[model samples]
Target: MSDPAKEYKQLKEDFVSNLTGGSIGEINLVTAIVPVSVLLWSVLQKRHSFFKPYTVNAFGLDYLINVGTVLLSFTLYSSQPLLLNALLIVPALAFYLTPPDSPTSRKKPDVPPKAKSKHGATATPDALGALPLKPFLTTYRGSMIVATCIAILAVDFRLFPRRFAKVETWGTSLMDLGVGSFVFSAGIVAARPVLKERAAGAPASPLAPRLVRSLRHSLSLLVLGVIRTLSIKGLDYAEHVSEYGVHWNFFFTLGLLPPFVAAFQSALAIVPSYAALAVVLAGLYEAALDKTELGAFVLTAPRTDLLSMNKEGIFSFFGYLAIFLAGQGAGMYMLPRNISPRPGTTKGAQRKTLLLTMAAWSAAWAALYFFATSYDYGLGLSVSRRLANLPYVLWVAAFNTAQILACCIIDTVFFPESYKAVDVSAEEEAHRGATSRLLRSFNRNGLALFLLANLLTGAVNMTVATLDAAPILATGILVGYTFVLCSVAIVLDELDISIKL
Candidate 1:
């Protein structure tokens, strides 16, 4: 008879193997529920005072409505996502239909008094105009984190549908998108420093100093990657070697990205833009995969030496780098060019910026559609998260661009006052509502949350027979796990603690 432990390991391996993923439309819709739910809950708090306590400071109630409900929709209701989506939509529709003269509407808007220098001259637009962008990014990023944390453990159980798991070699799935999205999100945020550096007008710092700074930034991630590798090996944990290869993990991929980008800073400067550079990189990489033997080697080569052993991780780094650069380009468009607006910055200028940003993303989406469908004329490539190929890069870029655009639209529709040019104090007050507290919490301690989730996943897997657990029990375990993560995040936020790296 086979050893039970060995048998269980094989069972787990078979579970995540050979997945082709579901339709993109469905995945997009299911993902859309996260932001929509945030919008709905926010509206409920504003339109109906009764929801304020429950949706705001109360932990249990807030978790159930915001985090828990999303968890359920992604897991239990995953197969029937449309029905779940409609459920969120109905309440939002009702809130919109409510009378305009309601008590909540009667309250005076919190417009801030204009700022004046001691000399009584009008001050330039305060940094507050940038505040509206924060929640949108926070919500987008927080939702991605929550989904990833849940999916990692949930995929081990029968309760979670297989379609949402990472695909074997090709095609799109929720989890596949998560990896790219994480890279893309990091890239978007990293753009700020690049913009700041350019705005400084100083000569580019010496290469050694820049490289040192880049290495310093990557040190924590590299340390985490090492710890994860040693722990997994020491524990003899079940792993899908094909995912990152025999030893390489996602953490290593993330850790190495910064130094690699730094090394290429000069090359990137010569390119018209990061996005253009990304296109060139992805095109060249895809050609290597298609026109040469690289693709065959990655798929079929024997694992031997250090390079061969971690082929997937090494080769895929360039693709992920492209994704990150593309994200930086997107950030340049979305984020303000300077820390402070120019002296004569006007509302019309802000409006123009917003419109151009929307138009740029819309064009990206349109391009994605053309390439994704036109097999004969376009790139005509299947998306391979494994290879991080061109189609996969484009898909990740376009999908995230769409989501960012959606968040912008949601913010504009629900909180139009935020978009208006206002002083920093006034802008902060406008966006300080209870609606996005949880998301803000998640954003504050994202790295901490990710690490905790990884530790918990290992602990749970070792202690529980995840594959053998009944569906209801599996779901209960998942709910409890998610609750713990949420509670920790909330507590950290309350204490004003942000654990970086």
Candidate 2:
């Protein structure tokens, strides 16, 4: 008889590669080990190239050095965090992009236009002509993120020093270096050839420099980039949380996205009725789940001290919300011509709005905290058994929804898409895009967040839960790491790191 467990294992392999030893921590370390090495190699070998300031490729060796060391430190710790308490700060590398093959190596092949129109094999700019080079540039963050993730998965070095001593574990690092880089790059740049190019009059290449694309294009591109990064991180993070036996809830997170996005779009839709309908769907699903034992199964998985670490407890109904919300926000951020090129936008109107929103969030939190103390508001979800509690879900959703609305508004008003020019024969636009930049940025930096979040969640579970210090340390390490992560992200942004992976 065929073993169901074997079939299940095969299916898992077919879909997602896991951490070593079937352990969450092992998986994290194994996946991270290779990425760290690649980053180190890239940093150690800093060389310049044609696309200097335009892409993540520009970070060169330093990108590897900084990111590599970080990954290595995280994965190395069985229970120890080397990155922060190192008392030893390694200098971040300084370098720029360089393709595997040098520009000089290419004598410039006579690249003929592949697309030939019937009019005497001539070319036209209307999706048939040569285009100008894209002037916009996405930071190299995406490349680093994907590359590192690939590296981690490829490599399987043990975080514990004892495990590292083994020969089998050693080879995993090299395997990761070889395979991870390719996959990571592929993930970030799966969409290069067919993206839109600018018309001939546009002197600059919009596609190459993503940020320079028009507002519509920019927003769309940004959303894609964000989705890619968040989705990857979200899934990965959920898996990590699952190690906690009860906290891992990516499905719960994902279930929330589709509806959130739908509801959000309803708000932005031509017909408000559509959005209202989406909300109805969201409510109905949760209600249905609430009415059934299935809902109970999702929220109230066997609460065991030992298994609780798995993080299996979640209202699956809300899992889709994250995806929906992220997608919806992206869609709205790509505004049509209605509010384009607004004047005095950078004058801080929205920034003030953001600040005000921040204050409002703080106040709401204080009130909620106080209310929870006085009245048992079921984990901040107003007196509900499951996620279907409308008041409970909306209370949290209010903030999430508002956050997206705010981001979309800001992006539309401030970060409009810029167009690129192309030659009918040989212009330099890589492709048309903008929204992807947000995602690309997210992708590149997503790993840092993922690692840090796991560490935090792990440590928190230890302290918060009745577990040993090991898990607590893991979670706390992440908590401490998060601050550093945010700062690094900000600095990377300042340094103009690539937003698109």
Candidate with best lDDT? 1
**lDDT tens string, model 1, 1-501?**
544444433432444354489778889877877877877766765665433332345566567656776787678888888888788889888986785456655545445456565677665664443323445666788877787888888889987778888887876898888899899988888777776676666676677887898899899999999999999999999999888898899999999988877776777658978888888888899878766667767766799898888888889898999999888888876766222366777654665566567668758745964675466877555778888988888888888888877776676566666556356554555555434666678877887898999999999999999999997899899989998999899889878799989
- What's the lDDT for residue 395 in model 2? 31
lDDT of 2 by residue, 1-501 (tens): 754444533432442232222222343444343233333332322232222333455343333344434444444443444343231223213332333456675333334444455766755556433222221222233333433432332122223233322121101222222222222222223222212221223443333343233233334334543454465466553232322133433223332333233233324345343223334554665455435444434343566654333323344334234223322322222211111245656424533444454445435534543453243554222222123233333333333333333333433332332232223443322221222332234454664444544444444433443223354453344334433544465466558674431
Clash totals for all candidate models: 0, 117
Residue pairs whose backbone atoms clash in candidate 1: none
RMSD of each: 6.7, 16.9
- Please, what is the TM-score per model? 0.87, 0.33
Q: Which candidate tops TM-score?
A: 1
> What's the distance in Å from true for residue 473, model 1?
0.9
lDDT of 2: 0.35
User: Where in model 1 is the C-alpha error above 4 Å?
Assistant: 1-19, 49-58, 100-133, 337-345
